[model samples]
Target: DLSINGMWTERLEDSCEKPDEHPTPLTKQQLEQLVRSLILVEQSQELRILAPEIKVLQEDLQLKKANVYRSIPYSRFGSNRDAHCYRKAFPYLLAFKVSCQEWGQVLLRRKEWDAVLEHSLMAWLYTSELPQWDTASHNALREQCYGVLAAHILTALQHCSLEPSRGHELLRRLKMAQLQSQSIVPCIQELQRILGWAQHLDCDL
Candidate 1:
């Protein structure tokens, strides 16, 4: 039996009997090609070019009974040492990174500071789906997401004034994510500085 995204095809009995006994993993060349296709798709905004590769990869993962976003385990003394465990899901994460960056660039270019901040916060919220392993690679990706969030917050402060209620709501969301206080201190300080200056100007009026 072969399944690709819920549509299953029945094979000969002999093939069906041992579907899981020996699943064929994607080759390194195939993986690289898929990643290249993903990059091209993102760059050109052409989904059709990558559709076939996505189907093949999806079928391969389905046969292996693997989740596309599954958390890969790593160990120094085991078969899954390092990010080799990320074999099947590397493209997915790369696609995510690319998409987030592109969105940030577009929003920044438009000077849509509030939209950029919201988009960055949304990306940070999605980081929970990433592998939680303490590996350097995984931590770096998480930090990148955090950096996007923090950078946008500061940028938005510079370009537009945030209402006190909206600012508090943003802080609430960050707290919900359990982000480190230091990571957001610069944003807080900048917001305070702007609000204080606004108050002083109002008093002069």
Candidate 2:
């Protein structure tokens, strides 16, 4: 029995001493494919988790007729008639704003200039769709949103190679926005200046 045990142990030792085979290193293309697959999987998982929350928020916004760009305080049990129910929508509006900003950052990183421009313009349009509230807080929020959009627009315009027709179209959209004229004016001017420079350089060439 001892001799048999010794023989078994020797066999195990020999097996352990043998060199183990290593996997061949992945090719560059294969590694890239793997990374893309991993990214897709992560994005899908994130979507699944966020979808229900998004639906709930959408329903809440619909029910409240909430303007995601505006915030007003809710009336208390014995509050004056001037107080409104806009506070209920504040959280949802905040979420929407955060989501938009995050998406904008992603687009900026990817250098999708056209999409970035469109995104900022769309967000600015949404703010303008609501009535202007005269309160300081409301004015500040509106200006802040406009400032962000203006920055995004400027960045897009500076980086994107826009054709004459596209530049004219952008100008038309900026004109249509009408709100935050100060912010919008600068963006319009910048776009025109960039286009002018491009044309001048082309003429020189």
Candidate 3:
């Protein structure tokens, strides 16, 4: 139990920090600017980050409107205010998709590929709750996912082949090469922990 607890604690330390993001309160002027800029601006890579953020912002904004309309007595705003807000947010949301396509070249760049892949996967996985990005984006999305998996598999073999000192050296190289990205080892360890828990429950069953 002591050893198990130690491993779990270490895993928590290794996991990525949750991003600190807040809703972008678009002013009337900002909204106009965004609409105008959408065409000529060329916002591909930015959309990779913005698409997810906008989804969350829209949801929050919808809830806020709902709270006001539902709570205000004798208000003409009606219970459907939230739905109306969502309609307004739709064009901007679709713009985000076009933006992603626009930035395809940036995403495909060798230096940014790893980060783009990881970011896109997170966007797709969380789409239901927020981004609402279309399933059509899955081709590039799956390619990046498979690329990461393949890289990890290769790393796993290299890790096993190395002496202890050489293994550490190889890991250092990966961290540098991958822009200080978190490693496959900790991710694998977390998977093992989850499987271990499932097995224990199965035995109990």
Give the alpha-carbon lDDT of every model. Answer: 0.52, 0.53, 0.35
Give a tens-digit lDDT track for model 2, residues 42-127.
Answer: 33444444222333323322322243333445445543212143333333334334434554555677788888887777667655
Candidate 2 TM-score to native: 0.55
Per-residue alpha-carbon lDDT of candidate 3 for residues 1-205, written as tens digits (9 for 90 to 100): 1111243223322221122332455454554354334422323324455333434433423442233233323436554324444434433333333333323233444335433334433333322223222333422323333345334434333233335564344444333333323334443333333334335433422
Candidate 1, poorest ten consecutive residues by summed lDDT:
7-16
Indicate the worst ten consecutive residues by lDDT in candidate 2: 1-10
Q: Per-prediction RMSD in angstroms?
A: 10.6, 21.0, 18.1
- lDDT of model 1, residue 179: 50
Deviating ranges (above 4 Å) for candidate 3: 1-83, 109-111, 131-205
Of the two candidates 1 and 3, the one with more favorable TM-score, higher being better, is 1
TM-score per prediction, in order, is 0.55, 0.55, 0.27
Question: What lDDT score goes with residue 59 in model 1?
Answer: 38
